[model samples]
Target: MATAATSRGFTMPFNLRLRRADVATLNDKNGVLEMRRKKRRLLTSDWGVVKCCCSDSVVPIRMATGSGNNVEKCEDWRFDMKKSQNSQVVRAPAMRFASPQPRFISKQDKFFPRCSPRNSGPQSRDSPPKRDTGIANEKDWGISLLNENVNESGTNEDGSTWYRESGEDLGENGYRCRWTRMGGQSNDGTSEWKETWWEKSDWTGYKELGVEKSGRNAEGDSWWETWREVLHQDEWSNLARIERSAQKQAKSGTENAGWYENWWEKYDAKGWTEKGAHKYGRLNEQSWWEKWGEHYDGRGSVLKWTDKWAETELGTKWGDKWEEKFFAGIGSRQGETWHVSPRGERWSRTWGEEHFGNSKVHKYGKSTTGESWDIVVDEETYYEADPHYGWADVVGDSTQLLSIQPRERPHGIYPSLDFGSTPPTDEPPDESSTSQ
Candidate 1:
């Protein structure tokens, strides 16, 4: 007797372990899929189990769901290294319904297969190339197969798995400072790198600047940043942080980047874990941002990151125009995040919102601008109104009401609702909402 395959549109679980080097995949006419590296397939179909042969290392079990044409293209997207894992488990607000077909019409119903972070995305301008071929190299920058410390995994404890590259790709002229290849992987995600810019005395190798991100064989121009990661365990948990740290760095970069990160994580006896991270960094004079983010959890994902900054004098006539934006969003739901401060002024320039689907229309004191715009003004007091919930006092007592007065927008300019938060409205406004 045999069991039926999981439903096509089912919420399949993902569990994977990709060892070093490149892996080759073999999909036969039969419903079976096979992958091999370094010429080995110790475990075959007769055993009714699939094993990723890492020399002598064992990776236990790997689970993936699909039938017929439902192969999942696993992807580890947009990461900043230090907090990559923070964005992993986010279940977007959109509903994801499983169905018999490979693709689902609703953004809410779409499904994706287990992704290979190897082909995940861009790490840098030019370093570890992305692999599309079925074969995985022992030098692949993926998670290790077995949590073993021996050379049994076919690659060196460090060299093969932990891939690192660095050089100065900032500044127009050669002065100093540097990019440090501080490496380490996030709790459940990709690698992270760093820069040693603040220190002037502790310089190493290349001492100048301006090195190409790709194919630049310059020295002291070692101004570069990169990262790596490793999975931690219990029995191995007793091995002192240092020993494990060494074992990890030998196989990852996060070990080096760890000294510069603040991680939030929880673990249990069964090895289940949850992790989130926050970090800040600067690269030359172009990028200035700080991020507080986390993903791949039970509920949803949250992210608050500053945008890349810019400022310049065009022909000296525009007179030093500059702009910056700050944004915050959570999960796949639309109309939930906000972006502010784009025009270099908070008072006159309005911030706008972008969501996935429909938006609610809240009742606000009409502005010279649209109903959505909220011009900054001196605070006296104000009541709030929602479509579902009737007009109510903002601070305390629900029955109490606050007075409202309109303030002038900068330069006597007309107000516009194109920017700023626009609360959604699917239901009716409070029976008879109040006005200014």
Candidate 2:
């Protein structure tokens, strides 16, 4: 006789690729997917399970359906079993064809995975309480995987398992600040997983800043690998940003195979200007930007000027480029553009500047292979000005991003990641510390 795999619905996603170090830690002594013949052990608090909310039928059925009697008998047997045994049993209700329940997709299904705090909604019971960690106005920082105390560890109602740990210690920088790491795994229809990091001092306040959410569907064909970050300046006002990159793999026989995009944006206070660029195609392929934009005015309006550029597979080799600056008070707009192409061994470039009805002039390279040019306007010829000829451009000047002094990495941890990297993990505490 053969056994059937348990059918767990979509609870969450699973990792598409485990780290090489994680792959080396899998136990190989027993069968990969089978339980060993051993005595039953009691469940522990550090590994408690939450019974699924939908394990029992919520809607009542009519006696004429014939399932009514079966449900009653099953309930009676379950009561008797509970008195005799301590093990748990999960059962799904039988659905009849006559009065099939209507199912609707949830809001979570509409949005692809993103890391943001949900402010308005009934929170999940498994979610930990919001704690005030005083991340703001703190200067010291440290990372300690060994010192992290298990804050929460349990199974979610959906069959996904989650664990959270928090720790802090005094280091050379100063008194250490609080930080947390939470992650979960699930084998529902798909093997799905999510990890989110929170810290008090990173952004001068408590915020869920870093996240890595990756998982593959049950079929193992469709998958998503995503990483994102958030940074804040204060409790209100505006927020500077962090980086985000997401890769979504397509299913078999799907058009547009699949798409990959990675982009980073930085915002600063001249009313908060944003600059971001994203590229298409696999990460390894030649990176060509798909689109980019810049905005300002407290993020409520676009900047006075806008620039547009399109890139393709040919290494930004050639595409359209244009810029427009608007002056609403004067009811006028200034525009500039350029076109370029690699012809033979040299490059041919054309430049144009337009000021509505006032002036519209064009300039081109002096020759087919020349790099300099001159444009004539109103019977006067002027040489093209070098944008950087006057000032010496200094490169490699590092910007100080943090307002407070830097902190030291906690010792005894695995290879430490600089400012932004995946949080490290430590060995679990002894079994004696865990309680049922």
TM-score of each: 0.22, 0.34
Q: Model-by-model lDDT, in order?
A: 0.20, 0.27
**Tens digit of lDDT per residue, candidate 2, span 171-238?**
43232444455555563534443343333232132122233334333334233333333333322333
Task: Provide the clash count, candidate 1.
Answer: 64
Which window of ten consecutive residues has the lowest lDDT sum in model 1?
A: 240-249
Error of 2 at 119 (Å): 20
Q: What's the residue-level lDDT of 331 in candidate 1?
A: 15
In candidate 2 the C-alpha lDDT for residue 374 amounts to 45
Candidate 2 global CA lDDT score: 0.27
Candidate 1 structure quality by residue, lDDT tens digits, 1-436: 1111111111111112212223344222221112233332222222223333211110111122221111222222112334322432211111111112222233322221112133222122212211111112112322222111211112222322223322333322222232333132222233232222111111111111111111111110112222222111123322100000000101112111111122232322222233323222222211111112112222222222211111111110000011111112211211111112324321111232222222221211222234344233222111111111001100111000011111222353432212225532212112121111
